[model samples]
Target: MTSLYDADGQALACTVIQAGPCVVTQLRTEEKDGYKAVQLAYGEKKEKNTTKPMLGHFKAAGTTPKRKVVEFKYFAREFELGKTLTIGDVFAEGDFVDVVGKVKGRGFQGVVKRHGFGGVGGQTHGQHNRARHPGSIGACSFPSRVFKGLRMAGRMGGNRVTIQNLRVLKIIPEQNLLVISGSVPGAKESFVIIEK
Candidate 1:
């Protein structure tokens, strides 16, 4: 994330994202696939790590193996198989888009860290051990079992999150980078899908 000066000469915080240098690998037609969508593939992979079946799929598209393949449904422009798309082709400065990606994964966590929960007990009067612990789950006999959907200490993070309406701050076509307003989910090097 960085800050850039806008036309008003005021500093605007932004995050530069590598939007794409995606390739069209497959096309979905209403008559054949019952849906209209374009399948775009990105990120290169070694031939040794890819399966034989996938090798054939990429061969048919006249491209090498790619790691991430996503289907997008839009008709802004006609896409051709084996065609490469850059940030400039699909987006321009001032365009608003939605970014979808997986959030960073944290191993099993307790309620205080996972759910923004306050500590169960105070630090004084021998309450030191109980501060970080989750309090009693529920009643003793009324339900017998803990009700579902109860927020408690459990696995957390590593969920798919979507940030909507982020305005495009700038576009650097030479390097195929997009600068957008605000932060996005996921760890560094994680893949994300941008939608208009």
Candidate 2:
């Protein structure tokens, strides 16, 4: 992520995304696949690590093995096999787009971090070890059981998240990079899907 300045001298926080050079690997039709979608492949991969069937798949597309292949439903127009798509092909400056990616995994987090809990008590004389613990979760006799869907300390993050309506700050066609206002999902170098 970086910062850009406008003519007014205000700094705009932005996220630079390495968009594409994506190859049109496959096509899905309503008659054959019972759906209409275009599958685009991006990022090169080693052939030795790729599976045999996937090797033939990339061979048919006349491209090398790609690490990421995403099927986009409802493309604006039809694209032929082996066609390459760059950042300039779809997006323009000042366009609003949505970015989808996974969030960073926080394995086995506590309630304080996971659910924004403020802890049980203060750091005064009587609050030694129970400050960070989850306060009473249930009644003693009425139901005598913890209710379902209660927010507790557990697995957190590592979920798919979409940042909506992000304004496009700039488009670097030469380098196939997209600059958008504000932060995006996932950790650095993670894959994200940009949609119009």
Candidate 3:
């Protein structure tokens, strides 16, 4: 994330993203695959690291093995196999887009950090070492067992998250980079899908 100055000299915080130079690896149609979607491959990978079948797949597309391949449904644009797509081809400045990515994993976490619980409130009235405890999990014997889907201390983050309607602050077509307003999901160098 970085700050940029506008025409009015106001600093705006934004995140710089390396958008893409994605290649069209495969196309799915209603008749052939019972769906309409485009499979795009991005990022380069060594051929040895890729499986034999995937190697054949990339061979069919006339491209090298890619680190990431994703299918986007309802893609209206017509593209030929082995075509490369850059950021400028799909988006313009000021366009609103949705970014989908996985959030950073926090591993095991307490309720206070995970669910924003108040943490027993200030250690008052003989409350010792119970600040971050999830109070009162269940009743004495009414339900008998712990309920399903209870919000407690457990694994946090590392989930697929989408940030919608983020304004496109700027576009650097030459470098295939995009500057978007506000923060996006995932850690640095993580792959994300940007949708119109």
Candidate 4:
């Protein structure tokens, strides 16, 4: 999707994705499996990338190579085994969906960079090396142990994030595209799961 904003200067068209014609590999029911679910396989990968167990699984389904497989819980009752469920089947324009994906990894960041902590001494009395430092970490003999979740410097990002209730602006079934009205997590071409 384009990164350009709308007429009102809000983010516009940030999540235009070419979604699925994913194959239904497995069907789960409440009686036998103790829950309801439908497993979907999408994105064909090379034979080399597939493992022996995965290849056997695909072979049992009488289908081709797939890169990603995921399960959807509490699915509708109308689904069946070996059904080729496409993006056109579930989603439509004006429908609300949730996009779940992993965020970009930024390893080993500082407190000001990672946790949005205001650092010490943009201007201070006789401060030399205190810029961007997490100052005053403790009280004087009152609470000597630093409090938990105090926004210290650490690893950042690369976490699973879900953007909820994003409106589907358009659906191009021919192109397998889903144009959503807001931002989704992860980078371009990364695997993301969209659910109603």
Candidate 5:
């Protein structure tokens, strides 16, 4: 969960992602659903997470019950209803994977912490007020324009991110665990996708 190791075994920092033995709840085809994809369901929560429409979705698939449905675009294979997917089939140990998840939200923050700006050069330079301020909105008299897409501080994190090509270390099929070599986003037990 913290570091990565190559095949020869050297430590590197990366993220770990645990894929699933997801259930094939829905199958989409180009002719019918206008796309080729498979809808997979993972995790099982209490009835609160299962709505009436979702209950019908599970019932139609004949699955034992689950939350968290995600669709994959592996258009080559055809998945039928109620088919159970396993980690061993989709990925193996030593395979490279991409981990996608929403990062933790760090509410509102200032420019110093958010954007990595070096504040105010030095305290003795009579620059106390500009210290953490974004500084310089526009030109004085030239074009006189504040360009868009500037780096300023506001809300941070809680966004979807995809970390690519993380090597898989251990695949424990018995415990349904994946000891990937590196760090994954979100806290422990947070849902994430591991894709090839």
Candidate 6:
């Protein structure tokens, strides 16, 4: 993340993202695939690391092996197969976009850290080491079982999250970078889909 100044000298917090130099691998139409969408491939990978069927698919698309292939439904423009798309072609500076990505994984977390529970209030009233405990799971008799979708902690994070209405602060067409206002999901170097 970085800070940028506006024309009036006001600073804005932004996150620099490598937007993409994505390739149009295939197009889906309503008559054929029962929908209208475009499939784009991004990043590079060694041919040896790619599977045989994926190699054939790349060969059909007239491109090398790609690390990520994703389909975007309801894309407005028409694009020919194997055409490369850069950040300038898709998004501009000051455009509002939604960034979709996975959040960082936090494996096997407790309720205090996971659900933000203020465990057991304070250390008073003979509370011994039950501060971080999630008090009172379910009822004993009656229905006699813990209900579904309880907020008890298990695995945390690593979920698909979308940050909407993030303003595109700056666009560097030469490096294919987009400086977006506010934070986005996922760790550094993870793949994120930016949609307008």
Global lDDT of each model?
A: 0.90, 0.94, 0.93, 0.84, 0.78, 0.93
Error of 1 at 124 (Å): 2.6
Per-residue lDDT of model 6, residues 4-95, tens digit only:
99999998999999978999988999999999999999999999999999999989899999999999998878999999999889997779
Better of 1 and 4 by TM-score: 1
- Misplaced by over 4 Å in model 6 are none
Clashing pairs in 3: none
- In the order shown, the candidates' Cα RMSDs to the true structure are 1.4, 1.1, 1.3, 2.6, 2.4, 1.1
Position 104, candidate 3: lDDT: 99
lDDT of 6 at 89: 92
The pairs that clash in candidate 4 are: none
Candidate 1 C-alpha lDDT tens digits along 38-155: 9999999999999999999999999999999999996667899999999899999999999999999898999889888887867887775788777988858888888898888888
Residue range 108-189, candidate 3, lDDT tens digits: 9999999999877676788789888988887568878888999999999999999999999999999999999989999999
Count of clashes in candidate 3: 0
Instruction: Report the alpha-carbon TM-score of model 3 versus the true structure.
Output: 0.95
Better model by TM-score: candidate 1 vs candidate 2: 2
Model 6 C-alpha lDDT versus the unseen true structure: 0.93
Candidate topping lDDT: 2
User: Tens digit of lDDT per residue, candidate 5, span 73-99?
Assistant: 975667789988887767787888788
The reply for model 3, stretches above 4 Å from the true place, is: none
Model 2: C-alpha RMSD to truth? 1.1
lDDT, residue 148, model 4: 80
Of the pair 5 and 6, which is ahead by lDDT?
A: 6
Worst lDDT 10-window in candidate 4: 1-10
Cα-lDDT of candidate 4: 0.84
- lDDT score for candidate 5 against the true structure: 0.78
Candidate 1 CA-lDDT value: 0.90
